[model samples]
Structure formats: structure tokens, C-alpha cells
Target: MEETGYTVGRMRPEWGKGGAQSLTFVVTEDCNLRCKYCYVTHKSKGKVLNLETAKKFIDYLLTSPDIHQSDSAVLDFIGGEPLLEAKLIEDICDYFKIRAYEEGSRWYWKYRINISTNGVNYDSDEVQHLIQKNSGKISIGITIDGTKEKHDLQRVFPDGSGSYDTIHKNLKLWMSQFDASTKVTFASEDLKYLKESILHLWDEGIYNVSANVVYENVWREGDDKIFEEQLKELADYIVEHDLYNKEYCTLFLDHIGAPYEKEDFNNTSCGAGKMLAISPDGNIYPCMRYYDYSLNHQPGYIIGNLEDGIDFDKARVFLLAMYKYQCDDECLSCPIAKGCEFCQGFSYDESDSGTNFQKAKYICKMHKARVRANNYYFAKLYHKTGIKRQNFHWKKELLFVLDDQYASFCSYHNEKISDQRMDIELVKEGLKFAEENFMKPVFLHSEQIADEYLTDYEEVEVLHRIPIQAYREDLPFYDYQIIVDDTSIDLLDKIPFQSNIIFNLSYENISKLSDMMEVVWRKTDRINLNLSNLSKTSDLSEYQRQLEKCAYKINEIEKHTGMLKELNVLTDIMFIKEHEGCPAGEDSVTLASDGHFYVCPAFYSNHLPSIGDLKTGIKIPNEELYRKDHMPLCEKCTSYQCENCKFINKRCTNEVNVSPAFQCKKAQIEEKTAMKLQKLLEGRYEFTNIISAKEFEDPIDMVLDGKMMRGYF
Candidate 1:
């Protein structure tokens, strides 16, 4: 049976407000150069858009309600070297300018025209005039592969002569005339020269630069090694020059910085459905990439024409398919699934009517590699600077218990601290150490607040763990947290809805608490479900099944009530929000009742060895084990949503960073389930696909498998 999985709620698409805010005009299909890796099949056909066609394209774009209401719109003129038709581009710019000033309306509406061109025609007087006249409104992006040697390698003239010198001279002239935002788009497969190329550009005073590896070509093992080496060298250069803090190196810094979430992941491609591309022949496609000379005449590729405007029905289907298209099950479950880009145009089959999903594998590998590299770079930088990355942090609070009179306090701690009062002297020393280390102290108690000890400290969270039947009295003096279990499930109805509570549940009792969800719901819509006391002997499979059942029950209730309820299940993996695994000791340390400091409360409860004691100060032994990137498997695994509890790892595998098989399997199941639910509710719900379940193994592994077929494994 195909399991659709339980939905948390309706996962609707965020069809953004307004119509097309950007349009790309493919001005021409003619170029003087014949690049080796060019995807265009008819670059030599010399099909260019006349001034009449340009006007028609602009008129079609202005018809959009989104454009009419907007303050500004982007008009991009793209290749086959858009500069080849510089006069037509200038005329188009003048037309918009005249409309903006002559007409008493804001129809032109602060329009910005962008020209993407090779530097070959940038030195022309017509192009210079366009740049000079519309200085602020027009931005030019010139392609210069790198240095002269690198640029001449692939980007040569049709007559087999190097155009690097001409391009270089023209780019210099273009940069002098254009005061607007100018960027150099460089591309090269020569890994050895990649950094040198970037440095060369910087040396030439071109700071705003972006470079990319030619994606259409195959990358060999040697090439991969070279790329890694080049990236490391580039990173070293960036750090040495303090470029990490500068905007000039944004392209490089972006890769190592926080990942961007510009679009909803449910939509497969970027700007495809939203942005229209008008080809030279007057046919409209989703984006410029979809405008294949041979394929643009087809049904699925072309969304509309200049004569009739957009074909809404065909456009809807294309957009929906782009949103619904998943490469495979692995892609749906991967941790960085939301960051993955899928373009049907990239994998479109000329011979067939639809896209070829198989080609996505190559692109997926490259993306994963880039993600890995970025994470690796960030991790290194974080450890060196004591700075935090997107999902990883270095600072956390130490929760120390002043009183342990509750029935649920760990028996190990209870037995160790029997009849022992709070050690005021040790706590004072611990507090001083915490202050020195910038660690917040969380005081947990079963009774009244320790006012005398906590008076001097203003930044403390006091958690009161009380039995459900206990009498309600005055609110605690500090920021309070209530800790409860399944026994207190019914009593929650009496508690205020705004109270922050942690509902503790053992793996075995999750299903039994399902009946009490109504009370749980009434108490707080966002309650944290803590799975307490998990060990190697625990039956995780049963726990998983119970959790799934619970999710279904809650979802059913939500469906009837039309109210969304969020359950933070072990299987609910949010990749973008929770990019790092459990902080454990890296961010936080726990000062236990026994006057000893451990990695976390779980470590103390489990009777694990303490890292240090109050008198000696906090000293974590083998601290590297708690770092997120320390484990090879964890670093490579795309399931970034896992709690990555070191205590659980030690209990299950006798290794801190090594995840138990059951834990990994359970997480994978949850990720897959979430993805399935998201896919089912794509058009209706506004949820991002953080990770996909699509399986992506290394491409080399497949090659190895073929070799192993002959007994090489």
C-alpha cells in the first residue's frame, strides 16, 4: 500500500502577491564567438529582435497587473551576446525613459534595464551611450572567464582567433563609462587557475564578481580533487585579506555564510513560473533557459505568444508540475532539500515530449558537493573565530539544580545526593565560572525559588517541576518553565494556555497520551514533546509507529476543527530551521546536583562521567566529540533535523558522535513522511520542502558499482 503519510496541516503554496515583476528579452541568437560548452544549438542563426518586436514585448509585460501596480520592474536583455544589438537596446531604453517623463503616469515606473553580454561589443559607441545616458537605471554584466589565458581557452572567435585582448580592453572601457552596479560573470573548468582568475579580476579593480563551474560538462575524479584544493586556497586567501567581512567578496563569502531561502522549496525551479522570457521570435517561455531554439516551438516549453499574451491554462500546468516535480525519494528526504534547485528545462529531452528525470542526478551531485564545501568552510571558520553559523552555536546555558525533591528526578542523582542540602560554596564558585565563560545559569527546583542565591543574578530561568495535583500558588519570581509528564495530561486543562511547558513522554507511552491531546491542545498549541530515557534496549520501531498514529489522530482533529496543530515529533525534521544537530556540550554544560559538571542533563541523569566539578571549574575532556562536524556520517548526511544527542549516541552505540542505526532509520522515516505529506498538500499549503527523500549517493559510487560488477568491490 502506498502511504500518503499524515499531514500536519494543509501544505499550501505561497503564490506570491502581484504579477510578473521581471522579464528577460532574448534580443538575439547571433554571436561572434563559438564557446566550446555553449548549450545553444542555433547560435549562428543570427535571429535578432527588431525595435517593433521589443515594443511588443514591453507592451505584453506592462499588461500584467503586478507590473502595473509595482513601483519598478526589471528588464533583462540576454544573449547570444545581447551587446550585438546595442542600438536596439538603446532604443528600448529611450522608449521607456520617454514614457516615464512624457506621460503623466508612472507606467514606466522606475524601470531598470539589465544587459548581460560578452565584452566583445562593450567598447562600441552605441553601447557606451546607453550606459552613460541611463547610468543608474541600467546595469551591465560582462562575461570574462578569468585572466587572459583562461578567457581565451574556450571563448574564442569563429575565425579561431583569441578575443581575450579585445574583450579585456572593451571591459575596461565599459567599466569606466558605467557607474551603476557592474559585475563580471566568470566561468572556468581549469581548477588550478580558478583562484588565480578571481585574484586577477580583483587586481583589475573588478570587485563585484561571480564565477561558476561549467555545469554542462562532466567532472572527473581528478577535477574534483583539483576543485577542492582550489577552494581551500581561495578560502585561505579570503581569510588572510579579511575579505570575509567585506562586501567586495560577497560571491565567495556567500558560499561560506548562511544559506539563502529566497523561494518556497515546493516550487522546483527559481523564477521559472514567475518570470517570463520573450524570445527573439516573439514566443514567450517560462525563463530564458527554457528558450531552446529547437524546443521553444513545442507545447510544454512555450507558455504563450506575443499575439495572445500568456496562456494561463498551459502556464498553470507548467508551474504546478515544476512545484510537484521531485527527482526521486532521496531528494524528498535530504536535509538540504529546500536548497536544491530543479529545472525541467535543464533536463528537457529534444526527442521526447517531457523532461528526463535521470539527468537530474549529475546536477544533484554538484549541489550536494557545494553544500558540503560551504558547511565545511563555515565549520572551520566558526571554530577558529568562536562565531556561530546558521544552525550551529557555541554558547549555551548550564541548568543546575538547587533542589531535587521531585518524584521524577533521576534516581541516580537522588541516590548520590541523598539528604544533601544545596552546596552554597560550590554553587558560588560555579556561578563565578559561568560568568567568566559567559554561560547563563538555569536554576531548576521542585519547591520555592532560591531567592538568596539567585538575587544577584538577573539572567536566570527558573524551572519548577511539580506534581500535577499540587496546589497552585503565586507565580515564580523568574522566567518560569513547567515540566510535566503523561500523568499531568488531564491537569493541563486547569493551567493557563500561555504557560511554557515541557511534556515529558517515554517512547513506550506516546500512544497512551494520544487520548489526552485535547487537554494538551487546550493548554498550549506549541508544546515541546520530550522523549525521555531512550536507550539501546528501547523498541524505536514501536515508538515510530505510535508517533505516526498520534500524528494521524491529531491531523484528523485539525481537519475537523480547521485549526492547525504542530507536534514536534522525533520524525518531524525541519532542515532550514534546525541545520545543526544537538548542541550537547558544545553550546551547553550541565552542573548536576552532585556538584559536578557534565555535558548535559541527560549525561548527569545517565550517570555519565562528569567533565569537571565546581572547585576545579568546567573542563570538558575530548570536547571535539560533541562538535557537529566531527562525525563523517553526520557531516555528510542531509538529515540536519536530527537532535544528534550525544547521550543517546553513547547509550546506543558506546560512541558519542556515532548515531545508532535505529535512530538514523527513525529520522529517515520521519523525513520521508513529512516530504510525502508536503507533496500531497503542495498547492494548498504554504510549507517549504526543507529536505527531500530522494536518494543521492556519490556519482563515483555508481561508477564503482559498475566496476564491482566485474568483482572489484
Candidate 2:
């Protein structure tokens, strides 16, 4: 019953795109320095992986059918200090490559040698020679906590002195040779140095920083608050410096603070049992953590030894079968449990009953604090970049954001674009891309731009809409559509008869909205309201009352005046039986003035990453998340009228597939109101699909409660 298709949530970076099988070799349990936070408790100069033993393991690995199944492999080397036995590692790697080639193994061509070191002997001639010998196949991640003060606080020598000077001197040489990231750890004492340490690393030209707090119970009572404050301070600095794209900190990733999907069920935190780890004495453990020196209470969890093959029963039943269900019930159903990280080895070490299945929850509060800080970071980043959080409802038609005026009409009005006319040739280029891709193009621009550019693309057929502040009767009325504001609805009387006009209702003018809807209904049935500004804390009952009153008023007018046309939120859903939510990436894409294709106009206006450019065509990363089947909450939702806005979803929930609380509440209210409207218009229209009421207000609650199955539609 293993689930598939869910991502590893965002704690770990998605590296090794080819999905390499990890084979870790604990070369030695010896080191050059005794760091205070070192996990290896039993560092012995006596224990070292001999060349013959490593060769034996390599032969077994290359000949095994299970190892050959992987298309790629990572020959990982770990130690109290991996570089301490640099010559042994070099010989092991050389022997592995030769044996794999001799056996015609797949790993010979696709393999990488990964090492994590303390950087004490990084500048040594032996280590330099080893690195040079295996130039293209090796990746080393050196450990440097942060600044001098931060590093000295936790990572010190046995003599109780800081090793920062030596590590700092060697850092320049390491940076000169490799553009690799440094690993940093945050403990209770060094929590205050979090910001400066990250900034210091950035100053040292190591822009990619992978830093995290220890998952031990060593955290003090108020350490979570201090952690939160430091993260916030770092977030502000990152925003102010505008180094988000240029720099990276694992804690502030874009994919954090999101709900877990159903497919994410039973997912383990790290690749523990799936990966292979061999000790110096030739005994095999699941990972480095299960090695005797790293564990506290028990001996190594040995699956087998080099003398015998792997014990499949112990490996599979006890190790490979590890999943999230094995954790406590609170963790099993936790809403913010997606990115919560845990160590399988640590779980076994800290478990009260000596069972690895009972995952240790020592990092729960620290993770929560990180999630909050991540939320603040992303919110501020989105705000600064003009990324809107509301649902973008542009139906299947492709929207061309011609200029500032057009973008303003379609966007949430967060930031007004400067008045700059897009080049006519750029429009032609976009039109050409759309035509070749078989997309229907609709242009949103001012009247003057339309006048100048509409004739430029005579070969392609385009639907152009003009956004005007006031009515202009003398304007040419060919096949053009006009987007009229709420205040200008009274000018409909002067508009030509049977014209296709879209009336944009700004809800700020609530009193005049009813009157304007009547005028818009009389003039034309096309109506669009900017309901994105509706607050989640607003009076839902009053909003429902207002909607009911408007629907009733429109119904009464149609009945008394004998008008054939009647358009409102209630009747709109009745006419369309199927779910007609905004399919931003699927049905439609927006081509901005920059000649790039965005998911929608909002994305372009907000400065979000475009799906593709003209040269690349369209390439959306994680495109499956945009579809309804992958959306856990929306897939089970009965709210067919829901906009299912990806922009809003990502903004509020940090995920595109999951709906936000506000969006879920709003969709629920609309669906309930639509059900009532269906009853009111029972005999008037022959509805194909009846709107059914749901027992729950939030779709996510039903999902978490296991009340609704996925793909409920």
C-alpha cells in the first residue's frame, strides 16, 4: 500500500534528478579535532575501513541485482573526518570504478562520490591529491557553522578552543576549487547568531546555505521564540538586500508551511532504510545514524555483514517499511506535518521502547517556529514583488496583457503598472506563438493601443477588449468589447445596442452595485465582479443576505419587465452545469508585454516566474500540481463554482494544489448559496446538474477526517 506521486515536501532539496541509489561507506571513526556538537561519540583511531574490505563491498554492490537496478549511484563517504583517511577513500573510489567497468555495471558511467567533512584537513596535500584524482565524480560539502563567534560557540576543539581560524583559512581554498554549499547547524546557545552567520556565509561568496536547528530535546523553554525572532530578522535582511534569488537558506524555502497531501501519507522524513550504509568493520546499517558511534543507547542496527549477504527480512520489514503512520497519532494527523523532519536513527535512539517506528517529536515546536517565519518571509516577498493572492478568473481564453491599463483591469489592483505602450511587433510575436500553439487570443488594452496595434496583426484573428474609465460613443464599434467600471455603468444607456460589454463591479460601491447590476443585465449579460478584496473576517451572513437580495432583485426585474435576459451569480451557475473554474495553466495562459507566457495575467502583473518564454515555448515546473486530480482538497470539493485559483492557493497556503482557509470558506458559502438559488429557480430552468449541499464547511476538514475519498467528483 505504498503511495506514489507526492513530493518529499520541501525540507530536502530535490537533487540528483536521475534518482541515484545511495551507498555510504563509513571510512573511519577517527578525526583531527573533537568538536563539541560532534555526533560520533566513539571516535577511535583503531577503526579504519581497510582497502580489501572496501573492495569486497564494491564487488558485492556491482554484482548484486538490486544494486544494478538503479540507473545511477552515489558512493557516499562519511567519518569523524572523512578527509582524515583521504588516501583510503581515493583507493576505494578507484577500485570501485575499475570493478564496475570490468563487470559492465550501469554505475560505472553514472555515479557520484559525495563526502561531508569538518574542513580541518581540507587544505592538506593528501586530500587535495584525492580530490584532483577524482575530479568530475566528487562533491564535497564542508561544515562551517557561520561566523567566527557562532562557530566557536558550538564547534570547538577538545582543548575548549575555537577551530574557526583553521576552517576559515581553508574555506578560501575550498571555495576556489568548488562552488559547493556549506552546512550550518543552530543550537540553543548559538540561536542569536543565526542571522549574522548566514549573512557572513553570503559575504564569503557561499550563497547557497543549508542551515537547520538540531532535532534534539536540548532546546530550552523560550528557545523557540528566539529562533523565530532570528529567522524573522534574517528574512527582513534577505528581503531588504533583494538577494532571494541570488541567495538561498533552506529554512526560507518557498514550499514550506503547507498542508500534506494524501499521497504524502506514509512518507519517511529522510532516505534512511532505502539507502545503504556500511561500517568500518564491514557490518551494514540503514544509514550513518545507525552506526554505533552516532547512537547513544543501543549497538548498531546491523542488517548483515560483508561475510554474508544482506538480510532481506531485517532490511525490509524493520527498515524499508518505515513510514509516517509509525509515528504518534498527533503527528499522523498534524495539519502542518508535511515538512516536519525527523531522523530514523535518532528516533530509534530516543524511543522509550527502543523502537524506531515511534518517531521522536523533539523538533515539533522548532519546526512550527520555522513555518511561521517562512510564512512571514514569503508574505513579505510576495507583497514587495506585487504578487496578488486572489483567484485569477480568466476563462479558457488567452489574455494578452497589452499595457498598464489592461493589466490594471485584470489584476487585483495591488500595484499599478507604469503607462508604457507595448511594441506592436511584440504583440505580433505573441500572437504568432499563440496561433502556432493553437490558443485563442484575447487582448486587454486601452483604446489607442488597440487602434494602433489591432491592424498590425491582420493575419491572426484576435479578440480585443478596451478598458475605459468613461463611455465614448464616437469610438469605432467593429467587433471590439469594452470593460466598463462600476461607476460608469450609467453610461450603458449611451452605448450601442447589443454591444458586448463587460461590467466590472468594484464592491466598494456596494449600495450602487444592485442598481448597476440591473443596468448591466438590461444592457448585456456579460458581468464580472472583482470579489478578490472580500475579507475572510467579513460578515458572512450580511454578505449572503446581500447576494440573496441581488439575486431576488434581478429575478423580480426579469419577471416583471418580461426581459428574456437575466444574469447574476445564481443564474450563472444554473446555465453552466459542469465545473467551470479557472484553469490557469491548463486552459489558458497570459502573454505579457515582456513576451513571456505566464499562468495568468495576475502572475505577469505580480512579477511571478513565467511558465515559459517565446523561445522555450511552455515548460511549467511541477505542472501536475495545477491539475484537479492532484489537488487533494479541490478534488473532493462539491463547490463546482469555486474559482480554484492557484495564485491565491500558493499565496495563503504555500502550495498551488491546496486551497486556503479564506478561499475554502468563500467557496463553501458560494456553493451553499448556489444550492439555495437552485431551489428558488426550480421550474424556470431545466438544470442538468443539481447543486448538492455538503455537511462540512471546509473541504480540508472532510479530507483530514477521512469522510470523503479523493476524486469525489
Candidate 3:
């Protein structure tokens, strides 16, 4: 079960020093019925919490300095049926009410007391009084399995009679008395029952419903198909009823267009570290699920008892274990890793006597299927509404620089012409296409240009590359971009202060460019560094060193001149928020000098096949090859900040969709470095709160064990 290359460990959650603000009390273990899927093994034990024990727990919480600093607190009561001990709950509420009035107005104004009930005793006078007393401060969540027929089949009375009638009556009364929270918790292999149950609840005006599949039960053939069909129907029903517009329709649909960040991808879901649950006997556990299992006395399970207070050392150990828990390799690489609901409780329940990883495989199929269902559900809604996915369009602010014949030749391939000059006719056609597409085109030329060629396109900006030996008098139009290399570093002072300039740095001359940072900074604020000659074998350390040097120099200049000199690599990550990657043929298609259309300038430079000719228009042969979705590894990746350059992918792996190890590593390092630099300049600069960075391990290597090299077919 060990994923090769990945070091299996738990991930700790970021929580406040005081620990969990919410506390659950397993008020009683006594039960009035026998449910088929009950997790509590000792429901008939009849153990219950008295007023004295409940008071002790509350006093401990309020006395703790770290825990008491918050203006709010949640006191949750869970049991075989918490309503069975209605007097205890009433007394607890009274105590809190008196405390608030005695202490101050805000003392208990924000405090909430909630209970999860089976709704069997909700019609009782005592329970009704409790609800009326704490109108807004107290909330109750009643669990209904749906229609009477389906609910009675699984949940029944002690004598085996149906309890649905009693529960249903109580639910309606509770709903009318107070605007309480309600949900239908159902689990069954029968598709008809499951479907009918949901529809029944919705028909009864129970829109805030939730359901779960029985993880312990094995799903047979056709089960998945049934679930998927039901999901589709549910989605349609939601749309038809306009439930999506309602704030209380608890089924979350907001993740539809939300892009996941790095923290979202690589994190655990367990609340063990932050939450504490106390049993009826006053022993403390991580959560209600862990407490209900009756394993509080077991080593690593219990934190401490009410008499001793919380064992901070044991709690820390438990939290650490949960934080370090990693799932199987498949789960690690899953596209919906951020949305996974697997927790340490499920792991503990499913683990075998001797192993820790076996349980993950059992639930893998269900988890993946559910993720797909959610994706499909959202996709269908967006399609029906004509809403597009985020970041699907090419960046509007980016300028596409189309290089001509002289600049198209690759330095490495001196004998071969990687690109040729576009004929004047083809250039005119391309310009027409660009204008029609609303693209900002910047024609890049190394040789001299004629006035007639420039007269036709006065609106378009022309970037002229000047050789080191060229005199400043020979420079082209004043407002155009000036392209220079290491050889032209000294001549930067002569360039117009308002003119945009790009300093191209190759591997051979990066050191030279690094030496002229002071001069480059003093010359102008509008300068971009274009790092070229990157390959699989490129020196990452050297590149990193140069970037660090540039960052240091920029900081120095900002300090002296009181003006920030932006380092493209460091500053770009802060603003280019979402993963825009390389937009090859999507927004700005390149028309090569040879009268053919390629995905971009990189395609022509790499000698890849042209997508189409100017006469035929742009028809991508295999459009998915250049799409982010088509890149299996990249789509699942949390490195959403990566450049995702298609040219780099193809050059290193000989495939447009497949990313090289070096490229992924480099992008991650750059993102991490940018985050570090961001912290340093936080208050100094008003950077837009766009990009967020987190420590990321390469999932492909960690999970696939290098098997991804065989291609994600």
C-alpha cells in the first residue's frame, strides 16, 4: 500500500492556540431503537451525563484563558438520542443564560447550543419549552431518512415497529415552533428507495437535505450507474425549483467555477486537533465519532477525563498523527483531492488488525465516482446557463510578439532556418485576423523596416531589436519596444525612459546581465527579463542564483531610489493570479512567415506542424493537445501558478501535454521563492492579493513511481 517515492505522513491543520471553539457532549449512550448502521456498540448501556458532570465541562471551558477569549462558543449534544435527557439540556441552557446576564451583555450573546436528535421526543412538553426558551441561541438538527416506507425499513423501535410516524410528527412541530436546522440522512443500496426518499423530502419542503453512501457496505453491480442517474435527476430538480438561488439549500454548488489553491489540494480533513468531544462518563476524545466508538480509554484515543483536564501532550500526539496521515497514491494524485471527504475516523474504522493503508483502496472507487458526479453536476448547470469556466480565455492584457525572418532562426540550429520571413501579403492577412480577433499584436523585426509597411498599421506597435553596435540615432520610432541582449546592456542608458524594453538573457550570458543590474535599474522602470535557452538539462541552481541576485538588486534600487524595480519572475507570480498557463492557439494563433498558422511562435521555432494556412483559417488538428484539460498530469496538479509552457513540455518530453520533471520542479521552486519574497515586501508594496503559495510535493513522482512517464493514456 506504500506509494513509491512519497513519504507517508499526516498533515497538521492550522488552528488557533485555544484549540476547537466547538465542543460536543455525548450526553447519553441509552437508546430507544435499533438502527442497522449504528456505529455505537454499547447503546443499551444506559450511561448518561448528569447536571454536575455537564457543569464541570462548561466551567473547564470558560476558565481556560485561550478557549474563553472568543466571544462565541458551540455546545453540541450528541447521543443515542440527546433528547432522552431533556432536563439536563434545559439546566445547562439556564446556567449559561444566568452566566451571561451576570457577567455582561456580550458574555453569552454569541454562544450557541445545538443538539442532533432522532426526533422521537420532540412533541414532549419539556423539549418544547427548551426550544421556546432559547429561540435564536439554541438550534436543533433533526435527522429524517426521508419517506415513512424507506425510513421505517432501517430505523425502527426497540420492539421492531416503525418509528417514522412519531419522528415525522415531531419534525413538523419542531419546524413550526422554531426555524430549526433539519436534514435527511439516508443510506441504502436500493436505488428506488434512495431516489424516492430525496424526492419525498423535497416535496415536504425539506430542501436542506444531505445523504451518504454506506462505506462499510459493498456496492454491487449497477449501483454506481443508479447513483449517477439519481445525481443527474437531483441536479435537474434543483435547477427546476430554482433551489440554487436559495441560501439554505445546503447542497454546496459554489465550487463550480472556483479554482483550487495549493493549500486546498494538499491537506487533511480531520478536525481531531482542533475539536474535543466528551463522553457521558466525562472522558474526552477528539470528536463525537471517536467518542461514540467507546474507545476513550484506549491508548492514543482518549485525551483525558473531566477531572484531570485535557491531556495537551496526548492531544498533540493525536493531532500530529491525523495531520501526517496520507492516503494511497491514487488519492494523492486525484484531481478532486481538495474536495475529498476521507478522514482519520474512516481510516481507523476501516483499517485491518495489522495494516494502515488497506482501507483507502476499499473507498477509492466511491470517492472517485462521487468526485466525477460532482464535476458533472456543476458542468451541466454551467452549460444550461451558458456560463463559461474561469481562466478559459486567453489573457487580454498580454501582447503577442510575432518575430519575423531574421529573429526566427534558432541560435543552436545555425544551419537550419527555424522560421522564415512572412510575405507582406501574409503579414497583412495576419494583421487582419488579429484586428478581427481583438488581439494586441506587436510585430518583432531584427532587420530594417520600410515606411510603407509601417503606414498601413499605425495602431500596431512594432518592437525593433537593436544590435549592440547600432548607434542610438539609428533607433526606430520613439514609442516602440526596444529588444536588447547582454551585449546591449551598456546602451540601456541611451534608450528612451518611457520606452518599454525587454532584456533577453541566454544561458551563456546570464552572468553578464546580472553584472549590469544596477545600470539596467537606473535606466528605466519598464523592463522585462526574458530567460531563454531553457531545456531539461538547464542549470536550475544557476538560474535561481541569478534570480536571487536580481531580487536583491531590485530591493537595493527600491531602497535608494524610493521606486520599486519589478523583477518579472518574482512580481509576475504575485499578480497573474490564476493559472493562465500558455495560451497557444486559443486566443492568439501565430501565422508563421511561411504562410501557415502554428499554435504560437514557439511551435514554428520548434519546427512543429502548422495548425492551418491563412487561406484555410486556423483549424487545430488535435486541439486537445494544446489544452490544459488534455494534460492529465497538469490538470490534477496543484501547481496552478506554473507557467505551463507548451514549448517547454514538447521540447523536453516530445509531447505537448506531457510535462518534464525539470519544468515542474522549476515552476514549483519559483512559486515557493516568490511567496517568500512576497512576505518580505508585504507592507512595502500594495500587491494585489492574487496568488497564494504553499509547499508542494510533485504528486506524479510521489504516487506514480515514475510510471507516468509511460503516458497518462
Computed on alpha carbons, the lDDT of every model, listed in order, comes to 0.58, 0.72, 0.59
Per-residue lDDT of 158-267 in model 1, one digit per residue for the tens? 98777889877776676676532233333335557777877777777776555555444366655655655566576566545645443243233322222223243355
Order of the predicted models by lDDT, top scorer first: 2, 3, 1
Off by over 4 Å in 1: 1-20, 63-71, 98-107, 179-189, 247-264, 294-300, 321-324, 342-344, 349-353, 356-359, 391-713
Clashes of each: 21, 0, 6
Compute each candidate's TM-score over C-alphas.
0.54, 0.58, 0.57
Error of 2 at 269 (Å): 0.7
Candidate 3 residue pairs in backbone clash: 9-324, 10-323, 10-324, 10-325, 11-323, 11-324
Q: What lDDT tens digits, residue by residue, belong to model 3 across residues 1-713?
A: 11121000112221233342677777788877787656665575568877787777767766655443454567778888888888888897787667656656354666678887888888888888888888877778787787888788877888999888988877677777555445554354455476567767767766556566655545666666676566656656654654544423323333321223445444455565467777777888777666645332222257778888888876665544532345654555333444345546555555654222233344444544454444444444443443322322112211222334333212221123434445677667776565433344555454344343443243233333443333255443433555666666767666556444566667776666557655666666755666667676776776677667666676677677777776555667676544556676554566666777777676766678888775676788777687666877776565555656677777778787777787677666666666666776667877654446544545365446557466653
- Compared with the true structure, model 3 gives a TM-score of 0.57
State the lDDT at 484 in candidate 2. 72
How far does residue 235 in candidate 3 sit from its true spot (Å)?
1.4
